[model samples]
Target: MRAELVVIGAGPAGLAASLAAAARGTRVVLVDAATETGGQFYRQPAAGLRAGRPEALHHRWRTWERLRDGLAASSVRVLTDHHVWCVERTSVGFTVHALLGPEQEEPAEVHARAVLLATGGYEHVLPFPGWTLPGVVTAGGAQAMLKGALAVPGRRAVVAGTGPLLLPVATGLAAAGVEVVALVESTGPGRLARRGRALAGKLPEGAGYAARLLRHRVPVLARHTVVRAHGDDRLTGVTVAALDTDGRVRPGTERQLPCDTLAVGHGMLPHTDLAEGLGCGLDGLAVAVDAEQRTDVPGVWAAGESTGIGGAALALAEGHIAGCSAAAHLRGTAPGPAPAALKARTRLRRSAAALDAAYAPPAHWPEQVTDDTVVCRCEAVTAGAVRDALGLGAGDERTVKLLTRAGMGWCQGRMCQAAVAGLTGCPPTPSRRPLARPVPLGVLARQHTQEELS
Candidate 1:
């Protein structure tokens, strides 16, 4: 496949970017790993499900409808189920290496003159005792199940986390007829109140979720954290504890809540694997972009959660700006102003920053992790192993990985890096891997032969 521009995601940002660029005369190809266009935020049910009211699963249904209908009517090519593993810089521009469909073995490629990365983000779930139980899932994973499959994780659920995501997940599960036992948030109300000025725009949306929670009669437990999950084979319950002003668990405030499901997530982190592979600069953990969302690398741009962990609105604004800039650059013309998008970007960014500040996980959370708790699920490495590695002079995550094999698993540290960093008292650092995902050796060998022949 070939195109003047390739947008690597079908989420809100990629959808908006592709439409914007196509409208400006750019031949764009929008690629995604999923079978559908909407990313996690606007995840849709499968066609086979024949959902009677898919829009009911989402809040911004009208916005999603517009994006979906716009793509269907646009000239841009849409390629779903293409799992991109690597992107190589070619003499002309770039070659996107991908695996076809769910099998993800057959190799495919898309050649493009320019690339936009809207790769999105993933949930950051800190490890707790019994978290590896079958019924314990990340808050996003639970939401994805309801949104994508029209299924609930369990009938009785405890949505425990310190982020804005918990509200929707709790209410959605409750509305789906699940008994939401409680919404346990580690962050206190005082923190959010302190950021009132910055989060003013989010008041209405928060209020709406609050109303839903109230309607569902779901108890809200603020300034609380899930200390541990309890189960023999699957999640049966969880121990909740109150947190002090300093983000430490208060003694004598621990209580056990009986629930079949524990949906927990501290927050999210940007998906920068592809950007790091492309040698793009990073502002801390996320991809670095200029005001127009263009990366430092020529012919490459990034928006949405790949650039930062903002919400859908910020991603849309950044995507529009990026698309307009990329189109103008390709057409050898000055970019036209996008005043409305620019304004939204500024305001939404402020709200995102405020949310980030207010919803931080408890500072002393690691203290609650039992020594035997498994931090790295893929390798089954325990917290004790990581602590032992620290005793062996492993001062950082890389050294801990080398000693304890904590991050040398299938995910290559994506899931366990934050946990390992917390256990080691080190900041999580950027990991640069040549391939964005695990590729079959056979596929690599075949690609090598083809490149040599070329």
Candidate 2:
């Protein structure tokens, strides 16, 4: 496939960008890995599921409806179930290499004059004891199951995490007929109160979740953390403990909460694999983009959570700006995004910063991990093994991975990088992987042969 602009993601950002660019007379191709248009924020239940009221599971339903209807009426071509593995720079433009569907064996490519990356972000699930158990799902995973599958994780559950995401997960599960035991938050109320002014716009949304929690009669355990999960084969319960002012577990304050499911997450990190593969620089852990959402690369732009983890509102604003900029550049006109979008971006970014400061994970989280606890589930590397590497003069994440193979598994450290950094007291570094996802050897060989023939 070929187009003037390619928007890589079907989420709020990509959808907005595609619509904007298409309206401005630019040929746009919107690509995504899912079977449908909406990204995780607006994930839809399969048509076979016959969902009666899917809107009940999500917020901003009217906005989603507008985007959905606009997509159906637009000229932009939509390609779903295309799992992009890499993007290569060509003399003419760029070639996006992808695999098809769940099988991920067939090769496909999209050539475009310019690329806009709205790849979104992934949940950060810091490991603890019994975390690898079947019922111990990430908070986002539970939400995904509920939204995409119309299914709950378990009858009884505890939503434990230190981010804004935990609020909705706790209430959503409870509303879905699950018995929510409690909502455990490691950060105290005082932290949020400190940033009250900056997060004023989010107060209404926070109040809504708070009202839902009140309606469900779920207990809110503030300044508490899940020290360990107790289970044999699956999750039966988790041990919760109070955190002191210093973010340490208070001695003798541990309590066991019996529940069938433990939905836990610390935070989220941006998905920058494609951007990094294309040699785009990053600001901290997210892709670096200018006010117009253009990257340092000449023909590349980025927006949404791939740029940083703000909510859907910021993403939409950024996407609109990027689309306008790209369309103007392509058509030899001046960029003219709506002033409202520019204002929204500035306001939402400030609120996002406040939320990040208020929802940081507990400082002494790694101290609670027992020696036998597995840090890297894919590699089955234990905390003891990482500590042994530390004893052998491994002072960094790279050295520790080299010594114990903690990050050499299928995920290539996506799940364990944060935990390893916490354990080693070193900051996590971005992995400059060539391919965003693993490709089949046969498909790669075929691609090589095709290149030679051409």
Off by over 4 Å in 2: none
Point out where model 1 deviates above 4 Å: none
- lDDT, candidate 1, residue 42? 93
Error of 2 at 228 (Å): 1.1
**Tens-digit lDDT track for model 1 on 366-385?**
99999999999889999999
- The Cα local distance difference test for each model comes to 0.93, 0.93
Which whole-number lDDT from 0 to 100 does residue 242 have in model 1? 96
lDDT of 1 at 105: 96
Model 2, 240-268: lDDT tens digits are: 99999999999999999999999999999
So what's the TM-score on candidate 1? 0.99
Q: Which ten residues in a row have the lowest lDDT in candidate 2?
A: 329-338
